[model samples]
Target: MRTQVCIIGGGPSGLLLSQLLDRAGIDTVVLERRSRDYVLSRIRAGVLESGTVGMLEKAGIATRAHAEGLPHTGTYLAVQNTGFRIDFDALIGKQVLVYGQTEVTRDLYDAREKADGIVVHELDGVELHDLDTDAPHVTYVKDGTTHRIDCDYVAGCDGFHGPSRQAIPKDVLTEYERVYPFGWLGVMADLPPVSHELIYANHPRGFALASMRSPTRSRYYIQAPVDDPLDKWTDDAFWDEFRRRLPHDSAEALITGPTIEKSIAPLRSYVADPMKWGRLFLVGDAAHIVPPTGAKGLNLAVSDVHYLFEALTSHYRDGDDHGIETYSQTALKRVWNAIRFSWWFTTTMHRFPGQEPFDQAIQDSELRNLQTSVNAQTVFSENYVGMPY
Candidate 1:
C-alpha cells in the first residue's frame, strides 16, 4: 500500500491530522493496534483551549461541541478554604470550552467516515523503517496477514506506549521526565457541579478540583498518594475528602451521588525533545505529556498537529520546507513552556511529602499573590486559557 502520509494511530490526534490533511488534498492512512471500540472506551480530560476549538472548527467537527459543551470565562482558585476567581475573559478576553475527549474522538471518527478516510484497526507488531531517509515505510500484521505501507512521511500519533516513539534511535531522542509523589483520585457522577466554573483548591488536607463534563454530569478529583489503591477509597470517602479541600461555600453546595466511574491518575511532566526525526514526526502523547493540573496534555498535541499540518501543507502546495525543518524545535518551545507551567501549578497546589513549613509558606505566598495581585492573575489567566499558538 502507498500513501503520502502514514499516520500510526486512530486516536484523536491522528484522526484530526488525517482529517485536516485529507481536506487539504493530502492522502493518508491511519493504523491502530486496538479496535475503535477500545480506543473510544478510554476516558480523558477535556478542557479545550480556544485554539483547539478553532482547530475543531476548521476540521468541521466542532458543531456538536459548540452546541453542547460548557463555556467558562474563568475558574476559581482557593487556598486554605478561601477562594477567588480568575476571570480569563476579563483578563485575556478568552474562555475554555469543556467538552469530553471521548466525544471529540467520536466526532473526529465520524468526520473521517463521512469523508471516506482510511483507518486500519487491530494491527500487531507495527514497525517503522528508514525514518532517517527521505522515504519511510511502516509494517504491521492484521489478522494473519503482514502488510506494508510505503509513504513519504510517517506520523507517530500512537501515544506513549506505541512503537512510534520507540522507533527513534536512543542516541538521538533525549527524554526528560518528573514523576510526582501524588495522583488524582477522580470520580464521575450524574450530579450537577459544585460550582458554575471549575474550582482548583489547595488545602492542608490536600488538593481538590471541582469540574464537570456537562451541567448534569460532574467530574471531581482530590490529590492522593500515587501508590494508593482504589479499593482504599469508597465513594463516601472520596466525597468527604473532596469536600474537605474545597472552599467552605462550594463544599456546602456540593451534592453527593452514586459514582459511575472512578480512577487514580498519576501526575507527571514528560517531554521528548526534537519531536521530528527525519521523515517521522511525533504528535501528542507520543512526544510529550504534561501533568493534568494545567490541562495541557491534549492541547499540546493539538498544537503539534497545527504545526505539522501547516508544515506538510506548505511542502505540498508551495514547496516550502521551513516549517518542516523547524517542526521539532518549534513544537518543543511550546512543549517546555507548558511543562514548566504544569510543574509550577502541581507543586503549588499539592502537599509534598516531607515538605518543610517554609515550603508551605511559599506556596501560600504564591497563591495569595495570585489572589491579591491583578498582574499575577493576568499571568495565570493567560496560561490557564492557553499561551497562544
Candidate 2:
C-alpha cells in the first residue's frame, strides 16, 4: 500500500488526524492492534477542552457531541467541608464541554468510515522502517499475512506502550516520568450526578472527584493506595467513602446506584522529549501523559494532533517544511505547561504518604489563594478551559 501518511493507531488522535487529512484531500491509512469493540470499551476522561472541541468541529465531527454533550461553565473545589466555585466563563468567557471520550472516538470512527478512509484493525507486530530516510514505511501482520505501507511520513499515535516510540533510537530519546504513590478508584453509575458541575475535593483521607458523563450518568473517584485491589472495593464501600469526602450538603444530596464500571487508575506524569524524529512524529499518548487531575490526558493528546495536523497539512498542501521542522519544539512548549498544571493540581489535592504539616499548610494556602484572588482563579480558569493551542 502507498499513502501520504501512515497513522499507527486508530484511537481518537489517529482517527482525528486521518479524518482531517482525508478532508484536506491527503491520502492516509490508520492501523490498530485491537478490535474496534475493544478500543471503544475503555472508559476515559470526558472533559473536553476548547481546543479539542474546535478540532472536532474542524474535522466536521462535532455535531453529535454538541447535541449530546453537557457544557460546564465552571467547576467546584473543596477543602475539607468548605467548597468554592471557579467560574471559567466569568473569568475567561469560555466553558468546557462534558463529552465522553468514547463518544468522541465513536464520532471520529463514523466519520472515517463514511468518507471511506483506510483503517486496519487487529494488526499485530506493527513495525516502522527507515524512518530517518526520505522513504518511510510501516509493516504489520494480520490474519497470518504480512503487509507493508509505504508513506511519506509516519504518525505514532499508538500510545505509550505502542511500537512507535520504541522505534526511535534509544540514544535520541530522553524520557521523564513520575509515578504517584496512589491511584484513583473510579466508579461509573447510572444515576444523576451529585452536582451539576464537577467537584474536586481534598479531604483528610485523600482526594475525591465527583464528575459525570451526562445528566443521568455519574462518574466518581477517590484516591487510594497504589496497590489497592479492585475486588476489595464493593459498591457500598465506594459510596461510603465517596460521601464522607464531600461537603455535608453534597454528601446528603448524593444519590447511590449500581455501578456500571469500576477501576483503579494510577496517576503519573510522563513525557518523551522531541515528539518528532525524521519522518516519524509521535502524537498523543505516544509523546506524553498527564494525570487526570486536571482532565488533561486526552486534551493533551488532541493538542498534539492539532499541532501535527497543521504541520502535515502545510507540508503537503503548500510545500512548507517550517512547521514540520519545528513540530517537536513547538508541541513540547505546550506539553510541559500542561504537565506542570496537572502535577501541581494532583499534588495539591491528594495526600502524600509522608506529607509534613507544612505541606498541608501550603496546600491550604494555595486553595485559599485561588478562592480569594481573581488572578489565581483566572489562572486556574485559563488552564482549565485550556491554554491556547
Candidate 3:
C-alpha cells in the first residue's frame, strides 16, 4: 500500500500529526506494535500548557478536556518547611490544565476514529529496513501475514527505541545524553490533590513533588536512589518519605489515598540533532526527552507536532518545501532550550548522595532565591507557564 506520509508509532505525536494532516486534505497511515487498548489506556502527561490547550481547542478536541480537566493558576516551591506560590497567571497572565495523558489518548482516539484520512494498524509491528533510498517502507505483520507500506515521506514518532532514528546511519547522527543518579518513585492516589497548586519541595533528604490528575485523584513523586528496587517502595514507605520531604504542615491528611499506581522513572535528558533526513521526520519523545521537573516532555511533543503540521501544510498548499526542509533545526532550537531547563531544574532541585555541605547549601540558596527574589520568580513563572511558540 501507499500514502502521502507513512508514520511510525501511533503515540500522541504520530496520531495527532495524522489527524491534523487529514483535516488538511492529506492522507497518512499510522503503524503501531501495541494494541489500541494499550495505547488508549496508557498513562501519559497530566499537565497541558496554555499553547497545547489552544491547539486542542482549534482541532475540536477540547469538549471533554474542558469539562474534565482541572485548571490551576500556578505552583509552589518549598524549602525548609516554608512554601511560596509562583502564580502562573500573576507571572505570565495564563493558567494550565491538569489532565492525564490517558484522557488525551482517549480524546485523540475518538478524533482519529471519526477522521477519514487517518489509519492506525494496532498490534501489528512495523520494521524499518531501509531509509536512505527514495522509497522508505515499513514492513509489518497484519492478520498473521506480512505486508509492506510505501509512502512519499516517513515520520518516526515511534520513540527512543523505534527504528526511525536507527535508520539514520549511526555515523551521521550525533547523540547527547545525561543519566541522573536517582529516579522518581511516583504514585497515583485516590485522594483529592493535597493543594490547589502543585508543590515542589527541596530538602536535605531529597526532592518531592505534589501534583494532581483531577479534583479527586492526586499524583505525587519523590526522589529515590537510582539503585532502589521497585519492591522497596511500598505505600507506607512512600508516605513516610513524602512526609519527611513535604514543606506543608498537613502531610498526614494530604497523603491519604488508596494508592492506585506506582512506578520508578529514572531521570535523564537526551537529544538527537537534525531531526529530519530526506523525506523522513521525527517528533515527540522520538526526537527528545526531558525530565519531569519542567513538565515539558508532553508539551514539547505537542509543540513539535504544531510546527511539523504547519510546515507540512505549507508544503502541500504552496508547493514550497522550504519549511519542511528546515523542520529539524527549527524544532531543535526549542528542544534544546527545554532540555537545558529540565537539566538545570533536575540538578538544582534533587540532592545527590555524598554531596558536600557547600553543594547542598547552593541548591538551598537557589530555592530560597526563587522564593524571595522577584526577578528569579519571574524566570520560574515564565518557564513554568511555557515559553512562546
Candidate 4:
C-alpha cells in the first residue's frame, strides 16, 4: 500500500491526524498493534483541556463529546481532608471538560470508519526503513503475511512501548525521565461520583483522587506502592482506605460500588528531545509522558497531533515547510511546560516513600499557598485549562 502519510498507531492522536489530514485532501493510512476492541476497552483519564475540546471540534468529532461531556468551572483541592475550590472560570475564564479518553478514541474511530479511513489492527514485528530520506515506508506482519506501506511521511503514534521512538538513532536521541516510586491504584465503578467535579486529595496516609468517566460511571485512584499486586487491595479495603484520605464532606458523600476495572499505573515524567527524526515524527506517548497528576497525558497527545497536523497540512496544501521543519521545536516547548506543571502538581499532592519531615512541610506550604493565594490559583487554572497551541 502507498499513502501520503502512514500513521503507526490507531490511538486518538494517530486517528485525529488521519481524520484532519484526509479532510484536507491528504491520503493517509493508520497502523495499530492491537485489535480495535482492546484499544477501546482501556481505561484512561477523562479531563479535557479547553484546547483539546477545540481540537475535537476541528476533527469534526465533538458532537457526542460536547453533548455528554461535563464542563467544570473549578476543581476541589484538599490538604489533610480539608478542601478548597480553585475557580478556573473566575481565574482565567476557561474550564475543562470531563470526557473520558476512551470516548475520545471511540469518536475518532467512528469518524475514521465513517470517512472510510484505513486503520490496520493486530499487526506484528513492525519496522521502519529509509526514514532519513524523502521516501519512507513501514512494514509489519498480519495474518501470516508481510505487508508494506510506502508513504511520504510516518507519524509514530504507537506510544512508548512501540517501535517508533526506538527507531531514532541512540546517539541522536536524548531522554529525560523521572520514574516515581509509587503508582496510582485506580478503580472504575458504575456508581455516581462522590462530587460533581473532581477532587484531588493529599493526606497523611496517601494521595487520592475522585474522578469520573460519566455522571453514572465513577473513576477513582489512590497512591500505592508501584510493585503492589492487584490482589493486595480488595474492594472493601480500597473503599475504606479511599474514605480515610478524602475530605469529611466528600467522604461522607461517597458511594461505594463494585469496580468494573482496577489496576496500578506507575507514574513517570519522560520526554524525548527533538520529536522528529527525518520523515518519522514521534507523537504522544511515543515522545513524552507526564504523570497523570494534572490529567495532561491525553491532552499533550492532542497538542502533539495539532502541531504535526498543522505542519503536514502547511507542507501539503500551501507548499510551505516552515511548520514541518520546526514541528519538534514548537511541540517540545509546550510539552516541557506541561511536564513542569505535572511534576510540580505530583510532588505537591503525593506523599513520597521515606519522605523526610522537611519535605512534608514544604508540600504542605505549597498546598496552603494554592489555597489562599490568588496568584497561585491563577497559575493552576491557566495550566489546567491548557496553554495556547
Candidate 5:
C-alpha cells in the first residue's frame, strides 16, 4: 500500500503523528508489532506536561483525559537528612497533569481507527529492509506471507533499538551517551496518595520519588544499583525503604496497598543528531532519550509531533519545504535542551557509582543551593514544568 507517510510503531509518537497528519488532510499508516491489547495495557509514563494536554485538546482527544486525569499544581522536593519541601509552582506558575500514557494512546488509537484514510495495522510484525534509496518500504509477515508497504516518507518512531536508526549510515551519525550507575525501581500500589503533590527526596541512603497515578493508585520509585537484583527486595522490604525515604507527619497517611508491579529500568541519556536521511525521518525515543527525571519523555514526544506536523503542513501549503527541510535542526534544539535538563536532574538526585567523598559533597552542595537559591529554583522550574512550547 502507498501513502504519504508510513509510521513504524504505534506508540504515542507514531499514533499521535498519524492523528495530527490525518486532521490536516494527510494520509498516514501506523504499523505495530504488538497486539492492540498490549499497547492499551502498557504502564508507561504517568505525567503529562500542561502543554501536552493542550495538544491533545486541540486534537479533540481530551474527553477521557479531562474526566479521569488528576491535575496537580506542582511537586515537592525533600531532603531525607532534613525534611524539606520545595514547591515547584512557587518557583514557576505552571502545573502538570497526571495521566497515563496508555490513556492517551488508547484515545489516539481509537481516533485513528475511525478517521478516514488512516490505517492502523496491529500485529503486523513489520521488519525494515532497505532505506538507502529514494523509496523505502517495510516488509512484514501477515497471514503467513510477506507483504510490502510503500510510502512517500517513512517515520521511525519504533524506538532506540528499532530499525530506523540502523538504516542510517553509521559513518554519518554521531552518538552521545551516559549510562547511570543506578536504575529506578518503580512500584504501584492501590492506596490513595499521601500527598496531593509529587515529592522527590534526596537522602544519604539514596534517591526516592513519591508520585501518584490516580486518587486511588499511588506510584513511587527508589534508586537502586543497575546490577541489583529485584528479588532481593520483597513487598515489605520495598515499603520499608519507601517509608524511610518518604517521611510524613503521620505514618498513617502513607499510601499503602498491594504491591502491584516492580521493575528496574536503568537511567541514561542518548541523542542521535540530524534525525532525517533521504525520505526517512525519526521522531521521539527513536531520535533521542532522556532519563525521565524531568518528566519530559512523553512531553518531548508530543513536541516532536508538533514540529513534524508543522513541517509537513508547510511543505504541503504553498509548496514550501521550509518546515520539512529544517525539521531535524529545529527539533534537536528542543531535544537537546530536554536532554540537558534530564541529565542534570538525574545526576544531581541519584548517587553515582563509587562516588568519592569530594564528589558526594559537591552533589550535596548543589542540592542545598537548589533549595535555597531562587535563581537555581527558577532554572529547575522552567525545565520541570516544561519550557514554552
Candidate 6:
C-alpha cells in the first residue's frame, strides 16, 4: 500500500491528524494494535483547551462536542477549608469546554468512516524501516499475513509504549522524566456534580478534584499512594474521603452514589527532546507526558498535531519544507511550557511525602498570592486556557 503519511496509532492524535490530512487532499493510513472498542473504552481527561476545541472545528468533528459539551468559564481552588474561584473568562476572555476525550475520539472516528479514511486495527508486530532514508515504510502482521505500507513520512502516535519512539536511535534521543509520589484515585458516578465548575482542593490529607463528565455524570479524584490497590477502595469509602477534602459547603452539597467506574492513575511528567527524527515524527504521548493537575496531556497532544499538520501541509501543498525542518523546535517550545505549568500546578496542589513545613508554607503563600493578585490569577488562567498554538 502507498500513502502520503502512515500513522502508527489510531488514537485521537493519530485519527485527528489523519482526518485533517484527508480533508486537505492528502492520503494517509492509520494502524492500531487494538480493537476499536478497546480504544474507546479507556476513560480520560475531559477538559478541552481553546486550541483543541478550535482544531476539532477545523476538522469538522466538533458538531456533537459543541452541542453536548459544557462551557466552563472558571474553576475553584480550595485551601484551609475555604474555596476561591479563578474566572478564566473574566481574566482572559476565554473558557474551556468540558468534553470527554472518549466523545472526541468517537466524533473523529465517525468523520473518518464517513470520509472513507483508512484505519487498520488489531494488527501486531508493527515495524518501521528506513526512517532516516528518503523512502520510509511500515510493516505489520494482520490475520496471520504480513503487509507493508510505503509512505513519504511516518507519524508516531502510538503513545508512550508504542514502537515508533523506540525506532529512534538512542544516541540521537534524550528523555527527561519525573514521577510524582502519589496517584489519583478517580471515581465516576451517575449523579449531579457537587459544583457547576471543577473544584481543586488542597486538603490536610492530600489533594482532591471535583469534576464531571456531564451535568448528570460526575467524576471525582483524591490523591493516594501510588501502589494503592483498587480493591482497597469501596464506593462508600471513596466518597467519604473525597468529601473530607473539600470545603464544608461543598461537602454538604455533594451527592453520594454507587460508582460506575473507578481507577488509580499515577502522575508523571515526561518529555523526549526533538520530536522529529528524519521522516518519522512523534505526536502526543509518544513525545511527552504532563502531570494531569493542569489538564495539559490531551491538549498538548492537540498542539503537537497542530504543528505537525501545518508542517506536513506546507511540505505537500506549497513545496515548503521550512515547517518540517523546524517541527521539533517549534513543538518543543510549547511542550516545555505546558510541562512546566503542570509541574508547578501539581506541586502547589498536592502534599508530597516527607514535605517540609517550609514547603507547605510556600504552597500556602502561592495560593494566597493567586487569590490576592490579579496578575497571578491571569497567569494561571492563561496557562489553564492554554498557550497560543
Find the candidate with the highest lDDT and give its number.
Answer: 6
- Between prediction 1 and prediction 2, which has the larger lDDT? 2
Off by over 4 Å in 4: none
TM-score of each: 0.99, 0.99, 0.96, 0.99, 0.94, 0.99
Backbone clashes, each candidate = 0, 0, 0, 0, 0, 0
Residue pairs with backbone atoms closer than 3 Å in model 2 (clashes): none
Residues 1-389, model 1: lDDT tens digits: 99999999999999999999999999999999999999999989989999999999999899999999999999999998989998888888999999999999999999999999999998899999999997799999998899999999999999988999998889998999998888999899999999988999988878999999999999999999978989999998998899889999998999997999999999878899779898999999999888899688988899999999999999999999999999999998888888998899999999988988898899999999999899999988888888887
Q: Estimate, for each residue in 1-389, the C-alpha lDDT of model 2 and write its tens digit.
A: 99999999999999999999999999999999999999999899999999899999999999999999999999999998789999999999999999999999999999999999999999898999999999999999999899999999999999999999998999999999999999999999999999999999998789999999999999999999868888899999999999999977899999998999999988899999889998999999999999999899899999998998899899988999999999999999999999999999999999999998888888889999999999999999999889998
lDDT of model 6 at position 56 = 99
> Which residue pairs show collisions in model 6?
none
- Cα TM-score of candidate 5: 0.94
Candidate 5 or 2, higher TM-score: 2
Report the lDDT tens digits of candidate 4 across residue range 1-389.
99999999998899999999988989999999999999999888999999999999999999999899999999999999999999999999999999999999999999999999999999899999999998899999999999999999999999999999999999999999999999999999999999999999999888999999888999999999989999989999999999999999999999997999899999999999979999999999999999999999999999999999999999998999999899999999999999999999999999998988888889889999999999999999999999999
User: lDDT of each model, Cα atoms only?
Assistant: 0.92, 0.94, 0.82, 0.95, 0.80, 0.95
Error of 4 at 88 (Å): 0.6
Q: Which of the predicted structures, 2 or 6, would earn the higher lDDT when compared with the native?
A: 6
lDDT of 3 by residue, 1-389 (tens): 88888888888778778888888888888888788888876766688888888878766788998999888888887876677788778777888888887787778778989875455555465777556677878788878888888887888899988878877777778889998888998888988888877888888888999998887888899999867887898898898889888875747557474688888888889998779877778888887888899689988988888888899899889998888989998899889888988898898888887888899889888888887888887887777777877
How close is each model in CA RMSD to the real structure?
A: 0.8, 0.7, 1.6, 0.8, 2.0, 0.6
Off by over 4 Å in 3: 123-125
Candidate 2 TM-score to native: 0.99
Candidate 5 residues lying further than 4 Å off, grouped into runs, are 81-91, 116-134, 248-252
lDDT per residue, candidate 6, 1-389, as tens digits?
99999999999999999999999999999999999999999999999999999999999999999999999999999886689999999999999999999999999999999999999999999999999999999999999999999999999999999999999999999999999999999999999999999999988789999999999999999999979989999998898899899988999999999999999999999999879998999999999999889799999999999999999999999999999999999999999999999999999999999988888888888999999999999999999999999
